[model samples]
Target: METRFLKWAEILDFLILIGSSVTLVAWIFGVPLFYHADGPVLSIFTSISLLVIVSLRLATRHFQLWPFTANLAFLMIVGGGNISSILMLLSAPAVHINPKSTLVMTSISTSIGLIFFSFYEILLYLRRTPNRFWILDDILIHLALVPGGLSLIGHIFQNPNYLSMSIDPRVGISLLEMAFMALLALSTVLSNPNLFLWKFLKSGTANQLIFVGLFVNQYIAPIIYLVLMHDDWKSGDFGPELFIFFGGVIATLGFLLFQAKLEENNSLIRSGIN
Candidate 1:
């Protein structure tokens, strides 16, 4: 029953992305949703990010491609955690979104997907389907990503001030760079999972080189550019800043540790030695 629900959740989450067709269109227009930069540099960088993400999607059928899938999902999940839009639908006045109108539309859809995907991954880990849920690897990922995503769901959806929060462009871009680093670390750690995709990836040296290069270029490089040019190197009280940025890391680690304890107890029961 849990497994079935998880599968449905993944389907529904993907459907949300599909519903946000505008994002895909904007992606094609060389306009990456989160980055609000203009000019040729942004155009080229977003184009490459699109190229890599699309490639990851294409390879999903035959290979696990968790790196790509997870990153894509993360993009959708974090694009815009704006609460004002939902609040507006509930009769509250609409609030401004930092991203442009077109981008905001897509980001809203992505933001909504967090609730479903986070639950799906949790069920996947708990269900422990053969090698599909390796304790060491899956734990690390869920620890880093799941809790962070879910914890912020409330802030994005319920807090009216969330969308209105002021952030230094440089800070936002730097935070994004840190996100890319977490993703890269995830990809490296789970590189050799026991799966069919591993065999395919291991066939030649070219695959590794291409995958790593695209990983950096498609995801990391753009953020580097964004932060470099993004200005406002200022400091302030920054109250909610902790929740906005590093919340995911703290949540991930805490939840995974607790879940690990539960899984250990469940394993003992399954083995019937106790």
Candidate 2:
């Protein structure tokens, strides 16, 4: 019964993730009723994604592979992405359409969420990993703060007009963010020089395929952002930002899979010796 319940829970979580992804894609592509001003579809999708992420964290609590504190820190990073999106959506009317004091407040809250989450990811990378990629991750995480923190401060000082002048600064900061991810991808590939060879020599397993997906997404996100920043740097285009944020998700999942493979290899070696 317990196993069956767990299976059902997993299915539900998968469905929720799929639903959120679909809605987000639709919003990005300007699907009918998705990019509208009034509906709460984006908010609902973000909220459900956050809940699913939280549940995954809880389910992994007993695994004991890494420090719970580190996992919590990672979860906080994930939560930051969700909260920032919701806050931006809620505050959109105030800044662009309606301009209400309450909406300004919501925007401020969202900025804070971004700040906290960005720092949390940095802190976790520094505390948990001794790999060369760790240093790059830490620096990039800090670099991400420049635009985000400034945006928050801009909101506080100018209220509804905060996001108005934030575009150039954000674009500059995101350039650094992209560079950081590029470094991460390079470091990973260099560290595991055989990663690609292994996948090619053997039929790519599910996990290996996921790793490839992550690598591609990481690089693709930064490149796309660079292009968008060049073309639409004036209006605070969020398309690239959203892509980079999800790129971070892909990077995290890839790191987790790499760790699992390392553990599995170690276990196999130990069993052979025994």
Candidate 3:
């Protein structure tokens, strides 16, 4: 019965992802969409829902893996960021806050979450397999977190404007994060090109599609941020934010996909027994 529920949950997640993608595309294409002042509140609710779904899936599937705990920790950190965003939104006046400041805060919370998750993942990965690639990935993830963490701390301290007047500190930090992501992509490609390609090809079709979807969703925002960094930072461009919104939507979908995958895999195992 649990397995059956997870399977249905996964399908629900896919539908959610599809819906989010459509909404984001519409917004990006200038569909004249307006969000409520409680946008972040809605986002937090979504994040919590995703977290619950993911937790259920993981508990049902890979509860025995040592790294599962680390993964759960990472999820919690991501959820915390979502919660923080909700708090910020609620605290601000009903009117729209300055986009630049909002962007900075959002980036800061995301960086903090990513850094914590990366460190935890690295530690868990190393415990399981002490490999050069893992070490490299760990270093890259840590390095990426540094700039954003520093910038966030600076903001908290109310640092006066610095020499780089035009460039928002968040943009610089985001660039570093993107560089790290590029390294991660390289590492994944180099470690097992066939497996990577196979995963991509299988993503939409395979039971493991949830993992693939999650992987893709996680990277999209950073990739978009990287592209936009080359442009003017102060222009209040909506491109990166749109990408981020989509990322959130994708994450929610991923939770559902994971739940479904667990049920499908379990069913196959049981069928083989028969």
Reference-based lDDT, each prediction: 0.36, 0.40, 0.40
Best by lDDT: 2
Q: Candidates 2 and 3: which is better by TM-score?
A: 3
Q: Give a tens-digit lDDT track for model 1, residues 1-274.
A: 4355444534433433342344456557766545543211112222233233323333453477456446445444332222433344234223433334333221222223232333333343344323322345444433334332322332333322222223212112122322432343343234324322233246579756754553334333323433563453212223333343444344433443454566566667898957
Best by TM-score: 1
Tell me model 3's lDDT, rounded to 2 decimals.
0.40
lDDT of 3 by residue, 1-274 (tens): 4355445545544444444344445444545123332222112223233334334333434456545555656555654654665465457523323534432233333434344444443343345323221233333433443333333322332332211112333222232233333333333233332222333345566636655565455445444564566454433233453456455544644454455455456667888953
Compute the lDDT of residue 113 as modeled in candidate 1: 29
Report the lDDT tens digits of candidate 2 across residue range 1-274: 4355445545544444455456445545556222223211223333333334434433453365756565555556565654665465456633432322112112333333334434544444346433432233433333333344333323322222334323211111122222222332232222232232333325448756765675466445554554555555433344454457455554654575455456556667888953
Q: Candidate 2's C-alpha lDDT?
A: 0.40
lDDT, candidate 2, residue 164?
33
